[model samples]
Target: LLLPYLRNKGRSERVFKDRSNPLEVLSEKELLEKFRFPRHAIQQLAFDLEEKLRPETSRNCSIPSLLQICVVKMDFFNISGFPNVIGAIDGTHIRIKAPSTHEPLFVNRKGYHSINVQAICDAKLRVLNCVARWPGSTHDSRNLVNSQIHDAFERGELQGVLLGDSGYPLKPWLLTPFLNPETAAQTLYNTAHAKTRNVIERCFGVLKRRFHCLHGELRMKPERVCNIICACVVLHNLEDQMLEEPALEITEAGDEDGSGHYIRQMIVENIFSA
Candidate 1:
């Protein structure tokens, strides 16, 4: 029901009515009759379960433990021919219904209402951190600055650098790709950066593929939508750890902001020129 509803909410109610029991398919009508409950009740039960089972990131990866993540990530990057990388960070837009108030703020550059969800993922495609509450109009850099990861790094609670796209700022703890490459070493740096950063893109693809609800426009309030996103992230991480699924292919996406361009250039010279 969740699958059908998420894929096409308008046609879901009629879907279960058309299938037969002999075909090993129970129509929506049959399930409804057997369960003796309305469709809304079932949906509500699923949401309740999700909320109850939502995994807490702090339990698995606390502030102090983040340094350990840095160690693991650096080793992972070494295997991939990149160095000193802790995690890959990026933001994706999650479509949502326009709110009654401040509806314009929810409209993104793509002219759709959404939530700008920022996430940091490790080499194994596990979501290390997620921030789902920001409106679509919020820039990726702004979201990063407000994220718990950023706060932890700022307070010296976490160590190592995170690789991001050009959309993010380049600080001592955050590294982004070069805007343009005029030297062979800079070109090599960009190549390695792209390869290492591709993990976050694959992570998003796997996440959206597993949870169809995120593929379509979420028909809930912003707060509920954020909760659902967080729940899905928890489930994705659990599945990633437990299942032996095939690897996800890497894909590329562009970034917009360059607030830390100068900082990025300085770091690029220091690392790649050596």
Candidate 2:
């Protein structure tokens, strides 16, 4: 019924007898199995969402803002570590529609039509910032370039390296593996730096593994997909608060994040000096 309405303009509701919206793509049992939301309750929630999101169905709305309201209500804002502390940044792919003609616009170097969802997390692995919907075709560096991260670096709001995996380009604001040398000196230095910087990976692994929804098919628009990611991040922070896991690393302190002042401080000055 809804599918015909969506396909044909000005179709009268009288032609359809079933209350079931065909476009919903889920039966009551299926919704319970997949989303765990009670079918009746989710029906109302979906209606409310359409009312709020598609007031006119003409103007686009931001997914992050809606997610922020839900997240801000959770008591997970105070992520530990300060001054010398900031979150790490990294991107993960969420599957999406393959463009009809412009395949290159969606094809990533990783070989998929996905968007890069980059996030910054605090020492405790709670996300402080999330940048979603950057095209998969863009490099991690380019995503940061076209993101609020550059602005944060310029404003001196972020004064530390956003610890990342090797996919990220080396910059003062962004920290990656040391490329200078493979000799004894550089190898030891790289090992030490990797220690403190790997917190983001722990966060990412936990996020993707625990919340199965994040890894599933995103049927909505790109913006809604991003909102779903943001919601998951918010949920992660809330769970962190509830569980309060002590210092997510299993190894002793000195193994990660590299040696002290030199590398981390260099990253800080290089970026914050902006």
Candidate 3:
């Protein structure tokens, strides 16, 4: 009796079954629809991360990394005739469980608990940078201002300008649409900016679609939620996927830099005026 009890004590009661691998069974198109990544890219990503992540027998697991593969060049000029634009910047809100600490800080204008995720994307809809640590109550401009990319631009570490919505401050390296268009050139610039910056909205759509957890409320702690968002972003960038887009809004008017206005005017006159 003691020997039989000892043998069963540490063993799991659950039975194991051999499950068919989706990577092996599904077609490329089917894989893309369900996993939001092509079969080849999925294989490559798994191969690259094999050493870092180990599969388990029971509970699901996730791998976190900021790994991004830039298979194409960074160029946005071809889109909407926006000249010399490298990337589009914007902020999105991801819903999460209300934290026990400072719950009010997570309530956004929409009256929900969420994280304000700021993401920058190139013309290919690949995420170039993602900042997911801000609360939903935080403004989009504030997130950008506090990001490392902002410091990089200030330090002249990155070239080319970024297209953003009016929620962001206009800077020498970042261009925002004109609130009131005075000329055809300004109108044209706003049009081009809108068309070009639209990619970031689409990027959010694709990321959320690929990782359905982003579509629903993340039940984890705030810090873990942020890590999950970043991991999803890295996975999203690993594959070239397509999805829908979202709308934008205006906010915070007084932070525009003087040199930024000059640069916008120059671009309007030189590029769009024609």
Give the winner by lDDT.
3
lDDT assessment of candidate 2 = 0.57
Model 1 lDDT, residue 87, Cα: 77
TM values, all candidates: 0.69, 0.58, 0.71
Q: Which of the two, 1 or 2, has more TM-score?
A: 1
Task: Estimate candidate 3's alpha-carbon lDDT, on a 0 to 1 scale.
Answer: 0.77
Order of quality (lDDT):
3, 1, 2
lDDT of 2 by residue, 47-97 (tens): 654443332211342223433333322222233221233446677777777
Residue 50 of model 2 has an lDDT of 49
Model 1: how far residue 27 lies from native, Å = 20
Q: lDDT of each structure?
A: 0.73, 0.57, 0.77
- Lowest-scoring 10 consecutive residues by lDDT in candidate 3? 244-253
Error of model 3, residue 151, in angstroms = 0.3
For candidate 1, the TM-score is 0.69
Alpha carbon lDDT of residue 244, candidate 2? 66
Per-residue accuracy of model 1 over 20-128 as CA lDDT, tens digit each: 4321455568667777655666566566556535544555443435546556566557745666666788999999999987899999999999999988787878777
In the range 64-179, model 3's lDDT, one tens digit per residue, is 12121111123477678777676788989999999999999999999999999988887777776778899999999888888667776777655567888888888998999999
